[model samples]
Target: MTLIRSLAAALLLACALPASADIFKCTDPISGKVTYTNTKIGEKGCTLLSKDQNVSAVPANGAKKPAASPTDFPKVDNSTQRARDNDRRKILETELASEERALESAKKELAEQESMRSGGERNFSRVQERVKPFQDQVELHERNVEAIRAEIAKLR
Candidate 1:
């Protein structure tokens, strides 16, 4: 892949005139060297720019070039974006399940506290201490789920 990209870059640079195009810095993937170029070439698998193969790039100084990432090039599709959305959905589903479980547990504890009060046990301070932490946990889960739900909606 590295050799192919370099040769393609060299060919493209050869076709690119010395004074006409902007030099783009491309690099070899195998080696972490920096490649300096005056052409917007080889970034997109050397297929996007179709300038005639008759011109050439101005020679480089001495700096090594790095391999061209997809970022160095551009593509038209929702592939990467969709993958991110799916990952986000998976994460949110796990979080939502956790929150629901906590909420259920909290509701049960609150109900138990109420039952104790009806059974002639009126020491409310200890009941509150037991329920407060669960209440806080449920609230925190609700808040987080809401925030994540909002973000997921935006992805749609």
Candidate 2:
């Protein structure tokens, strides 16, 4: 009889509670990106945000358009603009060439490090640490070269 009464009381308490959905927060281990969803739980990097709380979604407002330029705004002539563009292109090209040379130097240094066999460094981690800076330099220069080329291409 007591067990039946306890079950009835539990049921009543459950019914009295407000119905609120659960929110889960998930984070990517590699990218460190965070995402929130309603249905994920107990998975890797997924944690229950709140069981009793409710989250509301609101649409973002549209972007405001830019105001028109003033009538007295100064404008460059076509030939002047063209000359400026040519100068910009030349600068970008020079930067791209420099970056390419730096990248090649980094690659050569990394190759030399890899080829050298150090008797004291048997561990793979130590080798990786030694080569990491060279690798990073190569990657940085490569990205810079790519960006300079892109800017040059965008020139009129």
Candidate 3:
């Protein structure tokens, strides 16, 4: 008797709730623009779409899987791939070495500039003026070194 009463109460509650209608999409014929709303579209030549039926559910992972690579994609043989990797590594190493040398030179230049005052004026501006070029050079070389290192890291 209690189960029968529970079923009757559930049915009454379901009937009492308001029904939510599907979305309606209306498009402008000339401009090819679309508008979506839950209310029925009064415009002629509009499309009526069911939100629950048309929308696809995403997987539990919360990301769509990537499409597989095409079979006709160009591929190099193992020996050719190895040679390409070797060439890339060698180029990156050479650039890294060059950047290292430049960095050392920049540091030395900055140090030399720091050790001397260019003029008799004891103003802060004078000191800044003398040090700015060396500071800029050091910063440039530092950036170059970091970039070369990053490129080397990317090499296979």
Best by TM-score: 2
Q: Give the true-structure RMSD of model 1.
A: 17.9
**Model 3 agreement with the true structure over 1-156: per-residue lDDT tens digits:** 346879986786566645465667888777877877566656684777875443323354677467688999998899999999999889888888988898899999899888887568488788789889999988998988887787777766
Candidate 1 Cα outliers beyond 4 Å, as residue runs: 1-77, 117-126
Q: What would the TM-score be for candidate 2 when compared with the true structure?
A: 0.58
Cα lDDT of candidate 3 equals 0.77
Cα lDDT tens digits, model 1, 44-70, are 422223333333433356554665777
lDDT values, one for every candidate: 0.63, 0.80, 0.77
- 2 or 3, which is superior by TM-score? 2
Model 3 scores worst on lDDT over the 10 consecutive residues at 51-60
* TM-score ranking, high to low: 2, 3, 1
lDDT of 2 at 11: 83
The TM-score values for the models, in the order shown, are 0.41, 0.58, 0.54
